[model samples]
Target: MRSSISDRLSKMDKRLLNVRFKKSTASIFVLFIIFIIVFFFHPFNELTTVNLQSYPNLVDSLKGNTVISDIKIKKCFYYSSCQLNKVEQLQWRRLDSPLELYAAKPFRSLSRSMDIFNTFVFVKQASAQTVDSALVDVKITLKGEPINDSNEGWVSTDYDSYTIWKKFISKSHETFEQVDLVRDLDILFGMDDLQDSREYWQYQRTSIPVNAPVLPHLTLLKVPLTSHNKIFTEFHEFQSLKQNEVLLAKSNSLKIVQISDLHIGPDTGFCLDSSIDCTADLKSLEFLESSFEGESSSKPIDLVVITGDLIDSHRTKEFKSSILKSLSPILSKKIPFIFTFGEMDEVPLYEDKPEDENSPDESDLKVDTILKLNILNFISSLPYCYNKFVRYNQNLHGLTNYNMKVFKMPVNEETQLKLDEPAAIITVLDSENHKIDSSQINFLYRENQPLKSKDPFKLLFFHYPLPNYRPQGEFKLIGAYNDKKPLKKKTDMKFRDDIASLGYQVVSVGHEYKNDLCLLSEKIDRNTVINSMWLCYSSGAGASVGTSVDYDRKLRVFQIDFEKKQMLSWKRSALKGAFDHQMIHEY
Candidate 1:
């Protein structure tokens, strides 16, 4: 009986031990699972720094009451001369970091800091899970103002704050990439300090550590402007008709936005709002807006080429002002644009003012010539227009004729622009009288001389389109001017051939006011290799005969791959109509 009782007691004790063992195993499994969740979801690993400890005290301080400390903000203006220090030490404390403290250089400065704007903070990730494994959450405040969407004091929390805040995401183990914050800042306030409260300009960035229990908690690190250096760097200013070159991006693509025939004047729809049917100015403005909007969404407009006829027949000062005002909304974006003259821009020679007391006979006193020169000067003053060529090429009948070379810019600070092979040659030719004179052709040939051996991608811009030789669209050869005075041979049909022989892959023209893209296939070296020369016409933008007929205004955007010596794609963006757009042609 004693033995039986002992056995039963032993069995009960063993059962209790088994229950405890099972519970312990379950607890260990739960802890392991929790640790794994923290390891994968929460990335609280120490960041490695050069000339500094692998583990920073900021991580420990994150556990305490203090949010963050030991951060310095460096400020510098990015004018033509500012140099950005790209050292490894300057790469820390990104806005997305749990305890971020850094200053951003200004983007572009217009005359010192008048129109200066620097993206202050680009916090991609605001949360700890978004930051590091140990970090739970982080809050950003610019100038003692919280950036949360609930705050209506400093930021516009109504519509875009949430979206902008959500765009901040963890880019890598060390940094968070902020995409839309800069744009949000631009929208909320004006681009620079002057737009927002000027008083807050001094206070740049502040970070608040929200969670982490070990070190000082809620420690705030205010990164002030420690230093601002005004350093000058070498930059090439826009020179005269002698080749103003631009760098071709790594993609080997060149995008040209053609806005043609904006016949803005007092008579157009802008000044005639009372007449709803005569809303040409309004319609023209809408078309420009559409074209620009499309460009902003798609690839950036590398070069905006205005193919003549910017003004109407009524060349009054008021009309010119009205025209400038009408175009201000688009050109104000500061896009790089070049100009060519059209037939309508001409004021008949009879309308010229009396000659000056000592005006030379060689000096052109024709109203048309004077008007063209005055208009050229006016556009040259504009921020976007690049007509420096007029300053030097005063001998040409049409001062607009010149050439610009596009050079490939280096990939980084260490690399320099490649001057050996020009990426592309833009030949701005003069065809104001629907004719290309031998002198003009010779000028073009001279421009093409230096680039002859390089075999660079060539693009020709003028105001007239090649004559449609096909039977279906048989049209008079209008690309050249014919002398009304009796001459043995009148036709300038060889103009197209001359351009083709010079190896121009594309010819862009306006005047026609029609959106047309066609290939001029010609045999090269009389071999099997056929060169398909692209001829494109940008649709009329303003009130003109073409705009009146059919009323489908558009901007033609050409995307060319210079490396391949072929146009990758071409599309016409309609200003108005049921169809958004149709692909005109593609390579």
Candidate 2:
């Protein structure tokens, strides 16, 4: 019986072997036929029109016969008189981040995939009729390239493309200027040239420590100009930047509350009234009320200012109003309100079509495509916490006629602003604008003249600090590969010489959303006693990511001791269980 079973099994094995050989031959033939069909059809071979017309920023490249073949840069701090000749590399690789945006992100950012293997450029509007619209379409053609699975990747948040472009601008500032880059340019590339970040992002999202401090380095920064199209360091290296201490009071009799980075509704996950279904704005306000612990005091807030990014996007009027109205009820307590614009609140200067009411497709675009031609009204329409945010001291000793008497001035308007009482002024100035140097409001912060006029002390409010703050023409950073973003062409000389002409004392700003502080210690060219002051996101109310060494994240609170003539900034880490937020003792 065993012999018979073995014979049957051998026969079955032979039949199966024959069938397997025949199947293999058929499969090979089928594959050959499919290959031939694909070769003849060549359906995926069609060129993809880049619609260079869609993005006008490339206008600078229009005059380029010689494209940006490669770039090299060596940059340093603006104060380092390191002479242009010593930079060694004309490449802006060493230039610090020229273009940067500050706002917080959700603990969990949505991983959305974006195709970034495309070309982009800045261009000027074609005609006068385009002024009101803030955008114009250009007639330009672009070479096409094919995309493969490798070109697409999932992004958990807005990919900051402007950040990437800024790196390019920073790295090749010399090369582009030397090449006579026009207002627009074209980015032509081959199919294999497309780059991707899927692997990079995957590692970042899965790797942050749960108990980490929300330092600027760990947070993600998205460019406000281009569609948040680039990604930089996620595991940011943290550092503490120390500054000179200023004592506000001998015994401490003043209360200072810092409400920071209140980016009104648009472009971020924290933005409420948007599609993300978040109440971050409301929550921030609620948290603030809790922080303050009560309503209008017989003693008004020592000083108060929103500190830039009053509105998330330049054109989001209704959204901004919602934020203002919500706060109006609180300010009804008669507390002072002051704020400024971050990169998001200002009109974007990229060369592109000013998408408007007529252009429904672009009506929802975030950037102000038409740069110089843009309107301040769109920006002015939003509510700023104060007419100005400044760096100055307030005197509390006076005849008791009211809760608190706050005296200040605004750069945008001429009238002297008097709020019920101010805990402190976090001035938000438009550093990009050249006209602010002569600002009458700034004179108050520098000199104590306003304090002499019945008021106990005189203070000021404006965005971005002078002297200490680099205050250079806005540009966009450092990355693993190289310095990614660069400044716009010929945009550098716009600082210093212009500032030397405008004399002022102290200034405070909030575009940097880290919890701790990085105040500039440089004294004004004219004044030795007064140092230009800048405190980045002194209070980490927003989830904006920070940069390595220079910034980080934490919820900060500023305390005032007027008698001592100093302000103590206290920051508590929201990420770390530790309550030690950090101290910017008196910027």
Candidate 3:
């Protein structure tokens, strides 16, 4: 009448129900182990996000701002941080040990701009390669915003921002995309010797942008997202400070004195009279230096600009050494050296005396001359025939008769007489403009005879004159060649017109020792450009000044006053004596 003993036993076990629970638990344990393996060794997983659509909509406010307080980062989704306003219990993220953070109130700017409290922490995380929990041993600062600075040059901020973005990716194989926000800046905050390429503010422009109305206090937390969005930002308390601004200054009516061609040598009175046996040459320099020092006027010397030709010649090493020593007196002053190359400062391409075949011996040339000769020979080899002919001229013998009489005068003279005319120079273009004619130097500003007075101070310096001069003074003693035949081709029409067109008030020249300033004028149709100063001064310190030249000539010194727009000139005895007589001329 009964089924079996085994069947009854099975039925009894099922009724207990505890036996059924054991089998179900064992199956779940197996599945849990499989899940643990997938989580630890998987390459990358679908992003995990806690969807919370109930948060306050602050997207509109965050359109421009980098950090929006309305969205608080929680477990996974952004929460309604707006409702948590006021001193309400706040969630502050701790960065490290030395730093602290807090969120308090809203900040307001004078421009009526409003922004939530934004805080930053100045932490010395020496190894900021990767973010970690323990390295969070830093602090979030309450104040201390980074000041803006100019960038020296450009650099690559690509790798630097890549460091902060690396922690977000889930898989090791995934590479982070370059963020343009950080790519533009150069991350040169610490290292030196970067030269032009450098960035002053470290992470300010990128991650921790100062967008909102600067809050006072803030906290820096390392709480990261699930290896997808590695965001590192600040949690801050809002406090206000009366913001300040900066101002700048200006300078007006800046005046300066430009003095050039001040060939101050030891021999001020080297070339004077053959009969009088007196000294006077370069007499202007002594008075010029003292005049600048004596000027007790307002704005005496804001700046002393010197174009060039300040020295006679530092040709010999010994001569150069002496000059450097003497120059200390002037250079030690506060005057700035605004200088450029002059025809004399640098050595001449051609020799003062071309080598002569009449030399006592062929090897009489110095080692320097020999080296220069080699260079000349090599240059002659070029295909251009110009340099070959130049080389031929350079190698010519008795190149010039320096001892030849440049002038011839009567045996005796009483009144002031013409001593000697200037050397007949064949003008060559200066080093600046190579193509300038070498045969003609007619750029002198004095074409219109001679003049009496000039309104403004004008000066002209060059290597030649517009026309040949008749011999002057007594040259019988020195014995030199007189003026050569007039220029083969009539005076240059182009250069003559150019000089006459210049509206100069005064012009100072050094090449001629005519000791005169001719008031010149050119008839330009109905109008006339004339009466400008045509100053041809006398200075040949290292040479003789002929038979009848004066020992006490006009050592002219022109002074200018920009305030009143005036000019005062004087002449001295080259001995820094009272300008003896000052011609007070003003404009």
What is the clash count for each candidate, in the order shown?
28, 106, 37
**Residue-level error in angstroms, candidate 2, position 373:** 16
| Model 3 C-alpha lDDT per residue in residues 417-508, reported as the tens digit of each score | 22222111111122211112323223322321232223323333333334422223422111112334542333343544453244334333
Ranked by lDDT, the better of candidates 1 and 2 is: 1
TM-score of each: 0.50, 0.34, 0.29
lDDT at residue 509 of model 2 (Cα atoms): 48
Mark the 10 consecutive residues where model 1 has the least summed lDDT: 186-195
1-587 per-residue lDDT for model 2 (tens digits): 99999999999999999899899999999999997665434322121111112111112222222222222222222223233443433422121111111111121223522221211222222222222221111111111221234423311111222111111232223333332221221221111111111111111122111121120111111121221122112111100000110112212344445455555352222432345544454454444555444412423454454444444554232232324323533344434343444455444333244444242233333333322112232222222122311111122110000112333322124543343233233323443332233333343244333323321322233333333333344321110112123323322333433332233222344444532444333334454524333323344454332322112233344544445645444444434322433333442
**TM match of model 1 to true structure:** 0.50
Cα deviation of 381 in candidate 1 (Å)? 1.5
Query: Pick by lDDT: which candidate is best?
Result: 1
lDDT score of residue 95 within candidate 1: 31
Query: Which 10 consecutive residues of model 3 have the lowest summed lDDT?
Result: 238-247
